[model samples]
Target: MSATDLTSAAEGHGTGSSVGTTDLIDVEATDFMPDDSVAGAAADLPAADVAVRAQQLTKRYGNLLAVNQLDLVVPRGSVFGLIGPNGAGKSTTFAMMASLLRPTSGRIIVMGADPSKKPRTVRRRMGYMPDNLGVYDNLRVDEYIEFFAASYGIHRSEWTALVDGLLELVDLSVKRSAMVNSLSRGMKQRLSLARALVHDPELLILDEPASGLDPRARVELRELLKTLNGMGKTIVISSHILAELEEMCTDIAIMEAGKLLAAGPPREILERLGGARTVKVRFATGISETFTVADDAEQAALLRRLLVDEGRDVVEFVEHSGGLEQLFMTITEGVVQ
Candidate 1:
């Protein structure tokens, strides 16, 4: 089908970090964000143009296997999401991918290079922000960004324009003179992001980058991510916040017991959850068990139209496409050792 005729698809991104109004992608695009539909898949990403590739990537710490033979791909320029329950090897896998932790076996190739063997080379082209990624307590926002810039050996003449430009992009320009330790947790998160963009690396691996942000802060961070995505930056964000992830990612990998339980577009995964689509039919009273609709398209459409056309006392009507949160709860619930 043609791109426009389809339900959802990637719109071309703009120059600044945020995507324009046309590209508010939804769906299971990734763990952190889902597109409106499966193929609303970003057109900018090259097919199989993997920025991060791990196969049978296992990490065994003594007798404990943190990551068990996991395999996945993040297409170049795609904002991918990596999700799992708490302690589901999400951080461990991120460590392995970022070359922060050594693996017991298996292979990992990121951006055409083996990070384990050529870490410095790989790191030059990649940025990493761990769940607790830290900032310099003594440095001001500008100085913090400038420090990473200098570390990258950015040109002296260019660093000023570049650092200031990025700080503004992340909305931290006002805080440029503020000491790192003085900023709130959310502000520090933004600073961490600014540091990651210092070199304009080809790939970004952010672990729960929005973890503790307040609602407004989280929304701003989400918008910033969309902007970077529009600029063709490749991203792999790991999070357990399925609702937030639902807003931004294009492709997703759900992990349990150190293995990928499901890997596909978000919408498809929900469809695979089986049974009558969980439709929440709101009325004056809670939906009674006695109230049931037949499992047929006509019945489904009628229910939908009734809600849409009449705007009845229907408080909500989310057809239970078992969402990512539900899926995560299913796979990881009580599964952690």
Candidate 2:
């Protein structure tokens, strides 16, 4: 999508006319001066340690409650994953955090300021990538990126280098002159990500970024996210790809029916939920046995019993823990709202 499309989407266009590009760019040019009273109150809160915090956050679409009283915190410099089945309210929660949607009740702070009350503050410090990407007819990739850089009020003199760097960062340097509409779905996804990074925001909120990506593309995206996190950008991502999230996320939260089911480091949740580990043993006599152990202690005791207590000739002993996928299945009841 072009920068204009992004602006419209970011402002919640379904309820009203889309924000004009001129007005959005003009707003970007001026420094946002927040109300002193609001700023003063925010200053006293503990916002430095966390990038996002929601307390009793709720959102309703008329009679349908999209997000229940949800409470979540995303620590600074962490890759946090939000996972849920369809209708679990992950996207609704993300929209509220990105300041694109207002809550029916409750409050959320992004980068230390209330997003609904201080959207510009939150937006300036954050970048957002939605799941779907809209095509811009006849717009070249470089021009697409430059449009967003201009929208962010970056000086015209810096456009060339900024565009070059961004294209390279997303591995689209070869497609610099390619039309946005001509690019593949994966390429467009990467371009959308580059558009989000134009302003070098400290925080990124991505919803289903790997939806249309191939296996290779997904791996590239994962590595790129890790590189960005290493560079000090806090990322909040939602994906149905549980295995990928298990590999890259430092923390994860599972949601169902607009309510949080579990939240924390993945291993902690696994242990807390009694996610068992599987042990496979092979004997020199060609006998094989499988055992289920709850935790590391049990696995250790099982190994000792095989080698010492039973005095069996253990040829091979391997242990495997059910990662995020198993933990997710164990915790969520396949609930949908």
Candidate 3:
């Protein structure tokens, strides 16, 4: 690909019998700070501080624990991701963060407000696009967006313009007159996203926003998400599709069986999962297991130090972060659920 060409991917699947988890590593608080380029100016940077933070978040149902001491932090103007198989507590986590489910334990701060005690404030600041988006089937697209605008106490005069703008933002302006029920599955998903944006919320909690969409529709929605990020919207999304999330998120968290397995910038996660990068070896004729090293860095490095002979002359010594999928596989042998 060209330098200008960029790609990302999601990292999850529906729950299966056994839960799969990626590797986990501790990140210094410094990891969350904006670098020099990001700290330059408002026109050039997104929000300056943390938009969401979780400390030892936990939740339970009867005797079964739904969420473990999970920790997460999301910065403004970034697309953060959560991935895992079904029953991994991914949806439950989003709900608790959105104030829909009160966690049994742990602390959650969304946009600087505690959802536990001040759900209204948190909800007002957030636009949640849950998996089940029950839009008023009778209302036209424009009317649907307007209805939400009204509920938010927007003035009638401002409603039309805001609705128009939101429609355009979600790329559904052309469908303004169509009945909400008339839109295709993808269109409805986009419309729901539009509804979420109607209030011009600061934070967006999107649970499977791309679920059930055709390829074309999924691409369009991804593009819209990219635009939202460029416009400085802090978004948190959950998806079983690891490829999609990898494409859009700057940072991500991998969950399994109610616990966070890995969380950090993509490269950091990949490194901790087992690879520093990638290493390839070449031999004149062929070398057997002589060159093979364990995935663990310390063990591999120690072997290399002792086993490598100057006579053999290592043909290849390459180092690079492995692909997300490869890293994920190296860390866990089973399905993510």
What are the per-model C-alpha RMSD values against the true structure? 8.8, 10.1, 10.9
Q: Total clashing residue pairs per candidate?
A: 24, 0, 21
Model 1, 91-198: lDDT tens per residue?
998888888787788777666667787777668878999999577898888888878889989877776677667766777777878888999888888889878877
Kindly report which residue stretches of model 1 are placed more than 4 angstroms away from their true locations once superposed.
1-48, 280-318
Q: What's model 2's lDDT at 52?
A: 71
Ranking by TM-score: 2, 1, 3
Q: Against the hidden reference, what TM-scores do the models get?
A: 0.77, 0.84, 0.74
- CA lDDT of every candidate: 0.69, 0.78, 0.68
Residue 41 error, candidate 1, Å: 12
Candidate 1 structure, TM-score to reference: 0.77
Q: Worst ten-residue run, lDDT, model 2?
A: 34-43
What value of lDDT does candidate 2 attain over all alpha carbons? 0.78
Off by over 4 Å in 2: 1-46
Alpha carbon lDDT of residue 274, candidate 3? 52
Winner by TM-score between candidate 3 and candidate 2: 2
